[model samples]
Target chain A: MKLYELIIIGAGPAGLTAGIYAARKKMDFIIITEDIGGMTKYSWDIENYLGYQFITGPELVEKFREHINEFNVEIREGQKVIEVLKDEENFKISTKTDTYFTKTIIIATGRRPKELNVKGEKEFRNKGITYCATCDAPLFRDKIVGVIGGGNSGLDAVLQLSRIAKKIYLIEIKDHLTGDFFVINKIKKIDKVEIFTNTKVVEIYGDKFVQGIKIIKNNEIIELKVDGLFVEIGSIPNSEIIDFVEKNQYNEIIVDCKNRTSHKGVFAAGDVTNVFAKQIIVACGEGAKAAISSFEYLKYL
Target chain B: MEKKVIVYSTKTCPYCKLAKEFLKNNNIEFIDYDVGEDREKLEEMIKKSGQMGVPTIDIDGEIIVGFDKERLKQVLGI
Candidate 1:
């Protein structure tokens, strides 16, 4: 088997940035990812990603793709890394179809959406429950929908749905919406949007498709008739493939200032790690740092 | 006869792009509908699939929702 100098196991902001850095350093590396953009592609709008005043998620990811295309970086898309094993002095990555050997690995697998786990969620999945508003919001045009989550993700979904859905029920389990103040202000002015804090989804009920959702607010169970339910309840790190790395309470990989995981020759970056901030810009910086750290580690070997 | 593949998608959807790219890369010929603009196709997709989601792929009369790569490979025999 041909051993690579480095293998980046994602193509999000962090993984792509790491690829760019690795290529510039003239390192023998390849990026293996299930998808290119990761969670960034699901973003409705991004205003703080530096250089660009305002851009949509897909648009920003296109630029990332274009930037990486400039480099001779090899990206194996549609292949998800299922396992990572440390083999003596090298690391072995196993995907569904292929296996790869690398001297060092940079994990930037990012995160996946967290499910509400309420009843009928699984049965109604893809029926009326969707996690991607960027992909499915247009399907609910002129229909009624409910968005769960109060963070930036939920707010983003609500913002996207506002322009399409006839009425939106913004349900948040917390006492107040925790998204950016600007978004909250904008949402308040949308007459079709109804904000419900201290609310919890008790169950999702439907027939062939989603018909309504039962939510509890102020000890009262309210059944909301809706055509669709957009789940924006945040996400959990995609850090389960490798078990050797140390993780925090939230299961996010713990990384040092150098983006090094507990396991040597294995580094982590982006939303999968316990970084202070989960921003695109921050992930890109961490990815670069991880790539540099891996290069330095490879020098010692 | 080759399998009939139709992709109901929107331009801004990443998964839609992925689905289309996957088919194109595999040398599979498929028809793509921009349901976001084509109201008639959008309604046709919704009526056929009974759901509203982009990248709803129809492969030889089998409706596969979303970009499930493994499922796609299984259905397409790729």
Candidate 2:
């Protein structure tokens, strides 16, 4: 098996930034990712990332991939890393297709979408229930849709659906909508959007296509009929592959100021780490720190 | 003789683009069908492919789902 000086586990902003820095340092490394952009690709627009006033998430990632394509660092796509074994001196990373060894490892695997866990949620996935609004929004035009949760993602989905779908049901378990105030104000004005605060999606009922959602509020059950259900409850860190690694209460891997973990040759960055904000800019900043730290670590060995 | 390759896909699917790119890069001639908008063709594709996902390639009657690069390489003798 071929060994690398470093192996980055993800290919999002964090992983891409790390690859750019590593390549600049002339380090021999490889980035393994199932998808080049990760969950961030679902974002419709990002005005926060530096150097650009406004950019789409997918477009930004395309530029990031282009930046890396200029480098010597290898980029292996469609590789889902399933396991990581940290030995005394080196680490062995195993994917569904191949195994790789690396002197140092960067755990920028990031997070996965939190499941709704309601009945028929899994059975009706892609049938009508989708997590990615940007990806599946076009399929929902002129249709009736319901969005679960009250966070930024849910609010964003509601806003997106208001323009396309004929009707939208914004169901939130909390008493108030918990997204940005500006977004909430905009979504509240749309006549097609009917807000159902303090409502919980108890069950997802569907067959070949989503039929409706069963929501409970104040001991009363209300079933809202819709063709599509967008679940944006929350996110879960993608640390299942490295369960052996120590993590905090939120399942976020604890890292120092430099993104180093409790393990010697292992580092982590982005949403998976215990960072205050889960923005693209923060992820890129953390990634740069992790790469520089890794470079410094390699010098001692 | 060059084997006939047909791809059943949708406009919105990213996987379909990848499969098409993979085939194009290998200089393979293939027929394209958008199953999303074409309901009749979608049913026909599901009946043949036994799957609902896009980027289903029908290589001379053999159906393959997604972009299985290794399998495609094997069948194409690339």
Could you tell me the C-alpha RMSD of candidate 2 in Å? 4.0
lDDT of 2 by residue, A205-224 (tens): 87666798898989999888
lDDT per residue for candidate 1 within A158-260, as digits (tens), equals 9888988899999999999999999999999999999999999999999988999999999999999998999989899999999999999999999999999
Superposed by TM-score, candidate 1 places the C-alpha of residue A247 at a distance from the truth, in angstroms, of 1.5
Q: Pick the TM-score winner.
A: 1
In terms of lDDT, model 2 sits at: 0.84
- For candidate 1, chain B by itself scores a TM value of 0.96
Model 2 chain A: lowest-lDDT 10 consecutive positions: A132-141
User: Every model's Cα RMSD, please?
Assistant: 3.8, 4.0
Q: What TM-score results for chain B in every one of the models? A: 0.96, 0.93
